[model samples]
Target: MKTIQRIKNVILLLAIITLTISCNSDDNGGTIIDPEPTTISKYVVGFQAFPVGQASPAEYILDLPSLESLTTGEISVEGQGIPLRGWRFFHSAGNTVFTAGYSDDDKCIAYQLDENGALTEKANFAFQSTLDNYAALDDDTLLAVELTYGGLSDKRFHFINAKTGLLEKIVEHPIDIDMGSGTVEDPGSIPWVTGMILRDNKLFVSYHKWLADGSYITPDVDRAYVAIFQYPEMELEKIIEDDRTSPIGVNGHSTGIEKTENGDIYSFSTSALSAGFTAASKPSGILRINNGATEFDTNYFFNVEEATNGGKLFWMDYVGNGKAIARIIVDDNIGAWGVFKEQGEFFKLVVIDLINKEIKDVSGIPIHANRYTSPMFVEDGKVYLSARTGPAIGNNGENADLGETHVYIVDTETATATKGAKVLGLALKGVFKISN
Candidate 1:
């Protein structure tokens, strides 16, 4: 019996030793396991930087804690941030941010936050032509369009899965309109797609008739045209025209058309010479299409140029509550082609009440030049956009002193603006909020 008790005591001591080892293994360097890192969400700012001696500008995307925090200091992309292949346009849907290479590279890359709270490339896709226009059909899908210069070839539309960064489908449609008597090299007048939106199972595409000879000559400037198509099916329904205003939208700018919160679609027409129009036959104005309707409302027309006393609408985006934030060129003598060439500061930020057809200038923002600006980021009745204080490009095609570029925060209700973060680059291409 004593021998049996001795054996039992030895077993109990062994069990205690095992328990002590298991509990102190981490301190003793025995296969320690680390906790998983937590992922974070951040706001991203795309900056176009021109190094002092470089011939071309570099594109950089940097993640920030908040846009408002950039108000005091200058933000630069010098040893930090992700550099893109070339100059690109930025758009965000859901948690992913899409960047499309404009000229040299015909690729689109989607970026999202990683576990380290850094912006990382999520997916990459390529296209034959530059994506001129894009719209988010839903949180998961993005619709992009590519149109050739002369509109002689078939226009291609891409439906992409925004979440997966995959091209789901491609729809092609031929240009059936009479493009005048001209060869493929120089079609006298071709349809130039400016903006597109999807609403109520239908898609509306706004365009202008422009010359193909690189003259920026808008041939038919007295009519507003919108092509209506069946959404999801991608079938053409009809092309509606309104003679009340010039062609809807401008080249390289997507603010030519937008949809409001109440389901009403509004089209902006800038028949001003500064807005890539070689001629101004009709005054700049706004046209509307009622909810669930494909045709322009016959009784509704907002003569914006007349209302603002000759202020031409340069760009606009809808804010909620029947209002829109717009950039208006107040100078009547801004020479033709100067706006696109970045000649002077003629753009003034304003808030327009679409319901009352009234305009109020936003205080605190100086007259600025908008050679190339991204779509405004609108959230909770506030709009955020990059407002550069100087010209983006000099007259000699060299990098000019692009004064300070700041993210301007505009209050839709008060019609006031407060300068936000200062960019240490040539310009701030876009600002976005993305998640990992």
Candidate 2:
């Protein structure tokens, strides 16, 4: 009887151990066992290598503890960071980091933090054309616009599933091109998208008219145009125009239209030659479209050039509380393409109050120049921007003498800039925080 009782006890103990192991481990080979929840936070920084000897620049993504601190004198991707092929554009939504290849590749890859706190590829998808404008409708949906240039055709809008990295749907619409004076034989102007925003089931796209023949000439430079479309359906409702300012937004940089907290939409017009415009027909300014309205507000007009006494707006991002941080061009001699080619210190950081129409210059940051800068990151009323000083290009077609790149932390309320970590790359494409 004692031997039988001992055998039963041993069998019960073995069964308990087996049950514990089965609960903790994946029973099926295809099942993925999730790691324990972690409270640690990680930041992902995208860096672009200098295209000196290579045919195209390579992008690297590195996970860091903080963007403001660096253990070394300057952080580089020499033997670290996940290297990506070709020139890429980086954007983050929720916990995923997205890198869209440009010029060299037509793929967009989405990365997420794994159980080991490393950036692991989650999804890879391809697109026909480069995504020029993007907006996050929600955490799961990303709307990207592709402008079909070279001829009159239908512009494509892609609705992508952000989490699954799949193309959900594509909406094509032929946005009416305003060809002033020139006909089909000799096209005068083509619509160049500057910014896109979706608010209250309405989509607003701001664009400028430019010749598609590579001259970069603006045929209709005296009016600001925004095409309003219905959400989900993407049907064009109307094309609103404002004569108070020149074409809204600049080439390459998407800072044209910004929606405030209260739903008021403000469009910035860059009529400056420094912003890649062949001519300046109207003063660089700001126009407003009131909340719940699809037309421009006739009572609202902010003359940025007059307010700053001839300062041309280069790039801007809204912080919070009706305030935005803008990089203003201070030197008039930068020429038409000087912002891209001859970059002798010209950009000045300033805080503009959208509600009161006031401009206050930020202190502690010297004049700097940047080319093809990614969108600024705003968090907790502090705006983080990559500021680069010195020449934009060298005599040998290299990125020589292109001064050090530093992360500038700008305070929205105090209007002050505090320099942060030094980046050892051509420039920082983006800085993002992903929860781990």
Query: Highest lDDT among the candidates is held by which one?
Result: 1
Q: Which stretches of candidate 1 lie over 4 Å from their true place?
A: 1-39, 183-188, 212-215, 341-343, 391-394, 397-399
Runs with alpha carbons beyond 4 Å of true place in candidate 2: 1-36, 54-56, 67-73, 178-185, 341-343, 397-399
lDDT of 2 by residue, 76-162 (tens): 888889999887778766777788877677988888887778778888888988877776667888777775455555678888787
Q: List the residue pairs that clash in candidate 2.
A: none
CA error at residue 12 for candidate 2, angstroms: 28
Candidate 2, run of 10 with poorest lDDT = 66-75
Model 2, TM vs. native: 0.86
Q: The CA-based lDDT of model 2 is what?
A: 0.78
On a 0 to 100 scale, what is the lDDT of residue 252 in model 1? 69
Candidate 1 deviation (Cα RMSD): 6.5
Error of 2 at 200 (Å): 0.7
